[model samples]
Every structure is written in C-alpha cells, then in structure tokens.
Target: MMNSKQVIEKIKEENISFVDFWFVDIFGELHCMGMPSYSLSEDDFNDGLEKLDASSILGFKSVNKSDMILKPDPSTFRILPPDYDPSRKNARIFCDLYEGNRAEETRFNRDSRGITAKAKGKLKEFGLTHSMWGPEIEFFVFDAINIYPSPYGATHSYGGSGYSIESKESPWAKGNASTAIDLKEGYYPSQPKDTLGGLRKDICDDLYRYFGIQVEAEHHEVATSGQSEINFKYGEMTEIADAVVTIKNVVKVKAKKRNKVATFMSKPIFGDNASAMHTHQSIWNNDTNRMYDPNDSVAQLSQEGRYYIGGLLDHASALCAITNPTTNSYKRLVPNFEAPVNVCWGLGNRSAAIRVPMYLKNREKSKRIEYRVPDPTANIYLLEAALLLAGLDGIKNKKDPGDHVEENVYKLSAEKKRELNIGSLPTSLKGALDAFQSDMKFLEDVFTKDFLDAYTELKYKEYHAFAQTPTAWEVSMYTDA
Candidate 1:
C-alpha cells in the first residue's frame, strides 16, 4: 500500500543493492533486466523507472531491429527471495512497455501490461469496481522429457506405461507398485500412487514463503504420470496474472533442482488428461459481493452473476482464442475426459463449461463462476481482462445464459442438444481465431486493432510452421502409398 516514494525510501533503507525490472510478453514469457538500487532515487521512482528497447520483449522485432522502453509499476515492487542470492538481496518490479516519445505522444502499441491497465480503466468507466480471479493452474512434472528434432527424424518422450502408480525407477516411488492406475486416471491418490506429492508440497511451501502467494491447495490431477494442480486464493485480476507467472517460474526452478521437468503444454502426453488453468471469477462492488445472493436464486448466483455467465457463454468461442490459445489446447477440448467442451453452466456438473462449484457452500465470499476453457499457456492478463469485458457486456445488454443442463451434455442427442440450445466450444485453434476475428468488440477496449493484428500474424505464422512439419503418423500412414 506504499506510494512510489515510500517504496523507494524503503528500498534504500533495506540496503537493496539492485532492482530487477520484470515483464512478460503476450505469450506469457517472463523477461527481466537489472539496475543499481542507487539509480532508483525517489524522483526516479515517481517519474517511473524507464528502460530502452522492449521491442524484442513484445515479439515485435528481431535482435537487430529492437527498440522500445520499459517503465516499472511502483505498486508491483517486492524483494527478491533470499535463495535467488543470499547476499545483496534484490528488489523487483513489473514494468510497462512503451514506444516513441515519452511525454505527449508515445506510441505504446506493444505493451501487454499497458493494454491490461487500459482495460482496467475501461472496466471502471463501465461502473465495475473490482474483478476477482482464481486460476487453477495445472501442469505435469516429468522424470525426463527429451525432445530431438532432425531433418530425418524427431522424437519426444513423456514417461509412462499407460497404467502405473509408481515408477520402478522414480526415487519418490514407494509401495503399491503392482497396482498402478491407468493413464489419465491419477486423481487424488495416496503416497506411493502419487509420486509428485512431496514435490507439490515443496512447491507450495516455496510459493508461500518466497513469493507470498497464498496457495489454497495442491493435489494430483487426472493424469497418471506427474500431472498436478495447485489452487491459489482469489486475487485482483492483474495480481492473479502476475502471481501466475511467478508461480510457474518457481515451480519449474524448484523442479529442476530436484532433477525433474515441469511443463504447461496443455496436452504434453497423448491419451492422457491435459492441463488446464480453469479460472473462477466474480465481480465486487466496494464491500458488497455483487455475484452472491442467498435468496430466491438458481444455484445461489445473483441475477447479475447469471448475466455475466451469459456474456461469457455468448462470446466463449472468441474468448478461446485468448484463453485456450494454443494448438495443443484443442487436443484437450474433445468430448469426455472431464474437459468442458459445451458452453453451459450448471451446479455440480463437470460436463458444463461453466460450473458453479458446490464445494464453497455457506461461504458467500467464495461464490463465483468457473470458466474451464483456459489452459496454463495463456497470457493470464489478457484472458482475465477479456473475460471481464465480455461479462460486463453481457450484463450491460441483459443477456440471459438460459436454463442449466444438469445432465451429461455429451450423452444428449444432437436434436435434443439443439432444442436445449447447447453449443460446443471451438474444436481447433484456427476456429477459435476465426471466432475472435468476428466477435471481439469487447476486447477492443483493451486489445487495440494493431495488437490483435500483430498477434494474429504471429500466431498464424506459428500455425503454418506447424503445418509444414511432417509428423511421424503422416509418414506411417502414407509413405508406402
């Protein structure tokens, strides 16, 4: 809660020798650079900590063409963990990128953080105060993940026997080696069966003690080998996004120290449960919870809350381009496997894309709607901002999300589903992108046309690159013919 001047004075008082300016690209890749704490005077902090050339950081230019600026957000200041360097402890702040003139006419097209800030301002303009977000980030820890690519061949190994509780070779392996569960079936097992139990605990401890992230819980997800999920307490939209990047970094660093690899690649292993960062969100009006109503309401969700879900469901297809933004993300959206493919909300139903969790009963503050489309690979800032915008649009327009289908939607006949007005999410990245292109008015407040155009160009290039690659399956099926 300290101002920029107070933060600067505190840094000097704490004898912090250096300050690391941190930021992320549109793809959620973290970037950092350091400056001497002596250079971080009170005036400098108030004026903003500025740096040169963030073009590379924004994926806008190659090394040769890079030229941009970074200005630290004073509120994002924090002391670096002791373990990163025991001596000469460093302070850090997340930064905003800008281009061109600093005063009156700075062209800041490439700043993802700037876009998010603008989005927040727009939300305020629309009379929405605070947007709360809880991200259930899921990932897989592997004993070894080897990727090799050559002109003649390519191979990757996702270690598993399709059915196994304990790996004979895993150091964490213990009892019940003979009674292993099948692939994508490792949800909430005990010690020996859950190889990553100790690791998850260690990761959670580090997040709390080091980064100060309040982890709600950590547990095994529905994937046999090394799949896990860690739930953090709900936070302000931007704070949650920042926490996500920090959490991922901490997990990977800690895993590497223990000779393991962690991945958020949505669908790292074929025929297994894919990772998803299912987001739960709610709106608040000062001290009151706008999304909660204990009186005559379906599933205890307020009328405004239902409208928010309606907005999300209405724009769900376009939302996926930002939320489930990867080619691998599509692999997990298929029917079954507890993945929510249908665009509907229901209480205690896993088949619905939006589920009002029954676990938080009697806790008014905990009431929220979960959007299950997002994966960990998304830029959390953009995803959260877009969802907020869409939901606000729905509320503003009084859009109704309609009846909740408690029954399994997959089992319903096509005609029956049509009668019920159930719609499935986009099955491919291209489809998602196409949907975004047409139905992304809500995003315009945050994502400018230039940002969207550049992002589309970059993603399409990646898609084409993947398309040009000859997979082993293709060779096996058609090389002889």
Candidate 2:
C-alpha cells in the first residue's frame, strides 16, 4: 500500500494530468471530482477536500447539515490506462467520507467506505482477523440501446420512461444475424459466435494495467444476448469493493469506446439468463481458513461456517433489500435461470441461496461459501457490511443451518420444501424491504438508525414509483379492455 508521500511522488513521476477523487454514496453509485495534478498537494491526499456538500448526494445529509469531507485513501491510487482516456493521462483514488473539516475529521455514518471499515472492525471483535470476498460479476454488452417515454394522453410525457436494447449477439438483430447466439447458449462460444470476446479481453487488460485488479477468468455467460462474466481473485472485503467499482467503470468506459453499451442491471432482458454477482466468502484467523474442517465427514464446513450460513439463511429475506437492491432484481431471482430462489444452503447445489463449492474439497484454503442471490447492482460496501454482520450474529448465537440439500432445489415439491424447512426469498423489492424492517437489528452495530431510515425511505420511493408506472406490458394487456 502506498502512503501519501509515495502517491504524490508517483503522480509527478508518471506525469498524471488529472486525478479523480472517488467515493460511493449510500446507494452504491460512484461519485467523483477531478483536480489537475499540478494543483494537488500532499495535504489533499492526506486530509482530503474539506468542503464537499453532502446534501446533493443521496442518503447523505440535509441541506442544513450538508458539510462533509472527502479524504483520499492513498492506497487506492492508480493510473488510468490509455483505454480509459486517450486524450490525457488520468488517475484516481478512492476516498472516505468525513463530517468535519481537515482540522478534525470524523467518520460520516452514511459513508459507504466508512461503513465497510466498521464492518471489518467487527471481525476483530470475534477473533477473526480477516474476511475475504470474491464476486462473480456478470453483465451484458449491447450494440445499442434506446430509452424513450410513453406518451401521456397524446401530450407531454417524462423522458426515459421506457427502454429497448439491441445486440448482434441476439437472434433478433437485423440483417447478418446468422452469427447470433441462440437462446441461453452464449456460454464459452468462440470468435465466430462470441463477438464480445475482444471487448472482454480489453476490459480485463484495463482492470489489470490501470487498477491492479487480478481477474481470474472472463467468458460468455449463460445468456444469448451478450451476457458475460468476469471472475476476479478474492481479497479483503473493502479492497474487493474498491475493485468492484473500478471494474464497473472500466467495463462501461471500454465498451463505450468499442461502440457498445455495457450494463450491470440485474434483469436487463426477458426470457433469458439474467446477471448476478454471485459472491464467494470466507473468514480467516491468521493464516488458517476458519470456514474449513477436514474432519467433518459431511460437507467439510466448520462449526463457524455452519453458524455463518445459518445467520445468512435466517436473514436472507431482509438482506435482499441491500444485496438485490432494485425492483428489476426480483425478475432475475426467479427459477430456471440458474438463479437461487430458495433460502437454503447445500453442497454444490446452484439453486440454493448458498452453496458450498466442492471443486477443491481437501484444499482447506480454498473452502468458502458462494452466495448466489446478489446481483451487481448492489453497492459493494453496504452489501458486504450487511452480509458480514448477519454472519457474525449467527456465529455469536451458534445458529444452525440444518442439513444440506444435495438435490436440485427447483425440482423439490412444496411438501418436500416444507419438510426440509426451506423458505422462499422475498418475491419483490417491497417484500424484501418489509423483511428488512423486522430484521434490521442485526445491522445496528455498524449502521445508524438515521441512515437506515433514509435508505428505506429512498427505496420505498423507488418501489412506489415503479409500482405506479404503466409499462408496455400493461399497454399490451389492458389498453383495449
């Protein structure tokens, strides 16, 4: 990790023209302010910009109490690749939010990065030194997209009211569509069928060269319309969160450069596989993996691991508000698309919410649980914090996850599900928000009451707006009636 001095020196040595100070809001959207490198000082890197207005940022603060600071975290300093901006040299550093000025800064409760730090600190209280996370971030690339408005009484209408997307990867593309990928058959197609392979490689290259992210693998995913997945090596939760933000930016910018549009929406398409950010996680104590146990004849999960899973399962519905945080996310959580709809844990069962990967069984270090319900739309910092807290609660209470279901969960009858005590995840964003209302005590250690209230209020606004809107489906179904 570089210190403030080192970062300043490197900026000069590398001749970076612009340096962006970056941070995420409570809703997980990235916000940035750029400064000319010549104007940046060591104090800017150490103490941060002291007068950022928080009222303009969602879930931050009211106008009366909007004063906030953006303290740059020097370790996150990275040079942008030429692909990101060919016109000029650019770099970025992630920042932590603070309420006070440079004289005496205090952590802002609604700050995404600060919240993550608090969550990581909680691990120390449990005798765990670190928690690692690996996210299988999935997305889609399209040739073009059009977003238009539904006419309102043949008069004025709000813009961006409806949307459509196009891709050469889809069978519906206009002429020369012979190379289009068949429905749900885009997995691992070669050059002829996989038009986005070069784009993925370029994205991976930018991630490594500019951001220092170690991408493990990249390929087409299970959707025919340019759905893709890029697996990155796991790291501490906060570091991984930073990488996630970087990955999304790199993907979007690089795709745009290639005359394509990339999106991380949970369900951007219909009747096809939707994107998910299946997260693999594990706790560590010193050099040992706390999630593994060689003597366990069953799934080889340690007691701690079982309890963690128990916590996750018990609070799965509530966690959805943050992990799957979009109205469209529910559309992807449905069955038959490799998405986990049931709140259960199992060994190698993809349909279950949590799966214990057995690919490297005896390798203790590789043992981890993969949570399949989360999508890329989530704010990485908030998502990881809530997940860790839930797991920690389970560990403290010694929660039991019960027997693992090895069979296909989708095939299980209602009676069988009831017999196994398996439960269903919330079917909509509203349902998930309701669950969060009852189960939010688990997050009290890290999240403030005011922050929770603001978050829910914003989400409710979104839910209500979506519920009240008229869609093309409604127009098609009930317009004549």
Candidate 3:
C-alpha cells in the first residue's frame, strides 16, 4: 500500500499526464473528474480533499446543500493500460464523497461508496475482521446496439433495443452456419464455437497487469451471441467494490477498441440466458475462515454460516430492491433458465437463490454461499452493504434456514413446493419496491433515511416511466385483433 507522498512520486516517475479522481453515483455508475499532474497536492490527497458540487449528481443533494468533498484513497491508485489511451498517460484513484466543509467532515449519506465503508466498519461488533465477495458478472460483447423507445403517444414507434453480433465474432454467420452453439449451450467451448475467447483473455490479462486483480478464470458463458465472464480472486468488501468498477471499465474500454460493445444489462437477448452477477460471500477474522466447520458432518457449514443464510432467506424479498434494482433485473429472474426464482438455499441447486458450491476436497477456505438473484446492473457498493447487514442480522438472531431444497425447484410439482413452504422472489420492480418499503431496519442501518427515500423515489419514477410505455410485443399481439 502506498502513502500520498509515494503515490505522488510514482505519478511523477511514470510521467502521468492526467489523474482521474473516481467516485460512484447511487446507481453504481462510475463518474470520473480529473486534473493535470501539475495540480497534484499531497495535503489534499492524504489528509484533506478536493471539492465538488454534489447537488448536480443523482441521489446526492438538493440545490441548497450542493457542496461535497472528495478524498482520494492512495491504495486504489492504478495506471491505465496503454491500449486504453496511448495518446496520453492516464491513472485513476477511487475517492469517498463527504458533505461538510468543516475540518471534521461527514460522509455524504447517499454516496454508495461511503455507505459500503460504513457497513464494513459496522462488522466490528461481530468480531469479524472482514467480509469478502466474489461476483461472477456475466455479460455479452455485441458488435452494435440501437435503443430507442417512444413513450408519450400511442402512435409513436415503441420499445425494442436491437442487439446484433458481428459476422466474424458470431457463431451463426455463414450461408450454412457452422453449428451455432445452439442458443443456451455456449458454455466453455474453446476458439471456434467460443468466438469471444481471445477477447475475454485479453480483458483478464489486462485487468491483472493494470489493476493487480488476479483472474481466477475466464470462459464462454451459456449463450449464443458473445456472453462471457472474466472471474477474479475475491477480496474485502470495499476493495472488491472498487475492483468491480475497474473491471467493468476495462472490459468496456478494451472491447470498444476492438469495435465491440460490452453490456452487463440483464436479459438483453430474448429466449436465451441473461447476464447475472451471482455474488459469492464469505466472512473471516485475520486469516481464519469463519464459514467452515470440521466437526459438523452436515454440509460442513458452521452455525454462523447457516444463520447467515437464514438471514439472507428471511430478507430475500427486500434484498432484491438493492441487489436486483432495475426493471430489467426482474426479467432475468424468471424460472426455467437457471436464474433462481425460488427463495431457498441448497447444495449445488441451480434453481435455488442461495447455493453452497460443493468445493473440492481440502478447499474449505473456498466454502461460501453464492446469492444468485443479483444482476450486473446493481450498484455493487450498496449490494454488498445489504448482504453484509442481512448476514449479520442472521448471526445475531441465530435465524435457522430450514430444510434445503436439493432437487430442482422448477421440476418440483406445485403441491410439493407448497408443502415445502418455498417462496418466490419479487417478480418486478414494483414488487421489489413494495418489499423494500415494508422492511427498512437492515437497509436503513446503512443508508440514511434521506438517501433511502431519494433512491426509492428515483426507482419508482423509472418503473412508472417503463410501466406506461408501449412495447412492440404488445402491438404485435393485439394489432391484428
């Protein structure tokens, strides 16, 4: 880890032309504002901060309370890859947003990054030193996209965003297509069938070389077009949130250089797999793994681990508002495509919301639960905070997650599912909002009430906007009648 002085020295030695101070909006979108190397100041970099008008950003401020400060964290410093911008040397550092102008400043309540930091600090009460998350964010790299939806009038051209795969990258191109990986069967085939193999590899290699995120694996995910994943080793909550933003940026930047568009929007394509951010969560103190148990013969999860799952299941409905926080997010959560509709935990069950991955022998350190409902569109900072808080509630209350659903819930009969008392997640943004409004204790503990209100207000506006819009599908079905 570098101090402010060390970071400044590196920038000078590296001949950096520009340094972008990075922060996140409430929606988890990365925002960068910068200055030239001549403007570098150690006092502001380390002890003090740079100022900005937070009122202009979404979910942050009113006109009267517009002021905010950004304090760059030296540890998150990284130089952009040459391919990213060969014209000028560029580097980035993540920052936290604060509201007050005084010496003792308070973090901006709506800043997602700040809320995550507070959530991590809150873990101190449990004697847990850290919580780590690994999100398997799957996305598609398309050759081009066109999104144009009309909303105000019935006669207007309606909703439909066209996504097409480039002929060279697509498996379905020739006059007589060369066995096009058949829709949902694009998992793990190398080269010929897996067209984006080389691209994903480049992304992984660059992520490690630039940002110090070691790639665990990269592979062709289950989709025909260009769906893929570049997995990385998990780290602490705040650290991983920072990495998530960097990873998405690198993928998009690198893809654009090759004349491709990388998208993380869930359910971009119809009748095929949707991109999911299935987050794996684990807790530890120092170097000891807190989820494993040597004495327990049943599933090998500690009492604390089971309770954590319990808390997650108990609050799964409300958690959706944070984790799957988009109108498109619910479109991907439907049954039959392995996108988790049932709110139950299971061992190796693809249909269950929570899955305890059966790790290899002697790999107890890797034992953790994966929450599968979230999509890449979520704000990682707020998503992690929700998961950590929900898990902590489970640990404190000793909530027991009863009877794992080992069988495929989709295959189970309605009578059997009813017997098991299994529940389904919120079906849409409206359903999720209802759940969120009903439960505020866990969410409010991290997000200030004002922030929560603003967030929901914005989300409701989004939902209503979409809800009132006319779709091409509706026109196609009813126009003839």
Candidate 4:
C-alpha cells in the first residue's frame, strides 16, 4: 500500500499535471473531479478534498443534507495512459466518502466504498482476513450503435423508441454473408473469423500496462458479433472491485479510439447468448484457504464452503436486486441462453447458479465457487458486500446447502425441481426489489438502513421508467389490432 509521502513523491517524480479523484454512484457509474497537481499537498493527501454537495449524485443525499468529503485512497493511485488522456498528463485515485468535514472515522453511510470497507471488517469476526474474487468480464464491441430516441430539447421526434447495432462479425452486416461468425459457435475462433482479436489484445494490454490489472486470458466468447471475454487475476474483494470499474472504463475508451462502441448491457441482442460477469470467489485466513478441504474426495469443498453456498442460495432472489440491477437483466436470465435461472449449487454444472470448477489441480489454493447469475451492470462494491454478508449469515446460522445436482439443472422437470426443493430466481427487477425488501436482514451489518432505502427507491424509479416506456415492439404488434 502506498502511503501519503510515497504518493506525493511519486506524483512529483512523474510530473503528473492533474489528478482525478474517482468515486462511484449507487449504480457503479464512475464520477470524477479533477484538480491541478500543484494544488495538492501532503496534508491534502493525508486528509482529503474539500467538502462538496453530494445531492447532485444519484442515491446519495437530498438538497438539505448534501455535504460530503472525498478522501483519496493513495493505494489506488495510478497514472492514466496516454491513449486514455492524450490531452494531458493525468493520474487517478479512488476515494472514500465521509460525512462533511468530520474525521475519517465518520464515513458517509451511503458511500458504497465505505460499505465495502465495513464488509471487509466483518470477515475478521469470522476469523477470516480476505475474500478473494475473480470475475470473467464479458462484453460486445460494435462498428456502429444507434438509438432512435429524441435528444433532449428536440422539437420533433419519432413516436417509438428503438435501437440498432452493427458489427463486422455479425451475419447481418454488409458484405458479411459469407464471413460472418456462426450464431453460437464463435468461441475460440482464430484470426480471420475473429475480427475483434486485435481489439481484445489492445484492451488486455491497456488493462495490464496502465491499470496494473493482470490478464489471465483473452478470447472470443460463445456469442457471435464481436462478443469477447477477458479474465483477470483474482485479488481481495475491494481491490478486485476497483479493477472491475477500471476495466470497463479502459474497454470503452479503447473501443472508441478504434471507431467502435462497446456495451456491457446483459442482453444487447436477441436469439443469442448474452454477456455475463461470472464471479469466482473464496475465503481465506492469514495463510490458509478456509473454503478448501483435502479429506473430501468428491468435491473437496469444506463445510465453510457449503455454508457460503447455502447463504448465496438463501438470499439469491434478493441479491438479484443488486447483482443484476437493471430491468433488462431479467431478459438475459431466461432459460436456454447459458444464463442460470435456477437457484442451486452443482459441481462443474453450468446450468446451476453456482458451479464448482473442477479444472484446477491445486484444490487447496485454487478451490472456489463460480456464481454465474451476475451480469456486468452491477455495482461492484455493493454486489461483493451483499454477497459476503449473505454468506456470513449462512455461516452464522449453519444453513445447509442441499444436495449438489450432477444433471443439467435446466433440463430438470419442474416436478423434479420441486422434489429437490429447488427455486427459481426473480423474473424481473420488480420481483427482485420485492424480495430485497423482505430479505435484507442479512445486509444489516454492513449496509446502512438509509443506504438500502435510497437504493431501493432509486431502482424502483428505474423499473417504472422502463415499465412505462412504449417500445417499438409494442407499437408494431398493437398498431392494427
């Protein structure tokens, strides 16, 4: 970890002209406020930036109580690559928000970063020091993207909302009838068929070179039309969340430089597989992996591991409200799309919500659970914190995760699923919010009541907006009826 003195000296050595303080809204959209490098001192690094009105930020505060401080975390300090900011010598540092002018002890209740910090502290109560996470970040890159909604202040516009995306790898693109990628057979294709290979390489390089994120693998994903996945090395929960936010920003900026657009929306296309951020996680003490067991021959998952999975299944529906926060997230969770809908655990079963990967030979060091339900739209801090709380609750209550299914869960009959006491995830954002309202006791230790209330209120507004909007599909089907 970099201390204030080291950070200040590094800034002087690097001659960084400006420093950008970064923080996240409830939805994980990054917000930045930059200051000239000369304006900062050792004291500023030790204390924080001046208090600002946080009312403008979503899910933060009302106009009446808007004061908050941005306390920089020097450990997250990094120099932005030239490609990301060619106009100037720029650096960025993530921040923790605190109540107005108070000591750092008085953290803002609604600050997602503060919530993550509290979640980490809770691990110590369970005799664990770290919760490691690795996410398979997937997305799609397109040559052009068009949304047919009227711009703000427009006097005239179309009657219905619509969108169109174009990609050279797509079958429908001009002159791609012969060269287009096959529908669901786009996985692991080489040079000619995978037109986005160079783009993915550029993204991976930037992630490692500028952001210090180590790339494990990069390749074309299952879906066609420029879909890609980049695997990054796992780390502690908060640090990994920081990497996730950085990865998304780097992908978008790099794609734009190539005259392309990238999207992390769960289901951007119909009739094909959608993007997902399947997360792999495990718990650890100082030097021992708490989730692994050598004596268990079948799966080698320890009792603690079983309890964690139990917690995830117990709170699966409520977790959807945070992990898959958007209305369109449900559209991707349906059956037959490789996305998980059933709430169950299994060994190496992709159809199950939590799949225990068996490929790793080093079970003691590498054993972990891959939660397949989450998509890329989630706020990283909230998602990790909520998941940890739910798991810890299971550990506290000694919740039992039922038998691990060996068969494909999606193919199981409804009667069979019922016989096994299996349940399905919430089918929509409203369903998830409803579940969250009743099942939030697990999160009480880390997430403040006020924070959750504001989150639910903000998400309900999102659901209503999407619910009330008239889509082109609706107009087309009902126009002549």
Per-prediction TM-score, please? 0.90, 0.97, 0.95, 0.97
Compose the digit string of candidate 4's lDDT tens values, residues 1-481. 7887888888899999999999999899999999899988888766777756899998888899888878899999999978767888889999998888555458888888888889999998899989999989999998988987752212345444568889888878888855488678789988787998888998888788878899999999989888999999999988999999999998998999989999999888888899999999999998798989988887999999999999999999999999999998999999999999999999999999999999875568899999999999999999899888888888988889999988888899999999998999999999999999999988976897888888999899989988876667776897799
lDDT of 3 by residue, 40-84 (tens): 889877554556888778877878978778889999999989876
Candidate 2 lDDT by residue in tens digits, 275-351:
99999999999999999999999878899999999999999999999999999999999989999999999998898
Per-model lDDT: 0.79, 0.90, 0.85, 0.89
Please give the range of 10 consecutive residues that has the lowest summed lDDT in model 2. 151-160
True-structure Cα RMSD, model 1: 4.0
lDDT of 3: 0.85
CA RMSD of each candidate after superposition: 4.0, 1.6, 2.1, 1.9
Instruction: Please give, for residues 341-400, the per-residue lDDT of candidate 1 as tens digits.
Output: 888888878788898887865577888888888899998888888888888888988899
Candidate 3, residue 440: how far the Cα is off, in Å: 2.0
Global fold similarity of model 2 (TM-score): 0.97
Which clashing pairs does model 3 show? none
Model 4 pairs whose backbones collide: none
Decreasing lDDT order of the candidates: 2, 4, 3, 1
The candidate with the higher lDDT, 1 or 2, is 2
Off by over 4 Å in 3: 47-49, 148-176
Better of 1 and 3 by TM-score: 3
lDDT of 4: 0.89
Rank ordering of all candidates by TM-score, starting from the highest: 2, 4, 3, 1
Question: TM-score for model 1?
Answer: 0.90
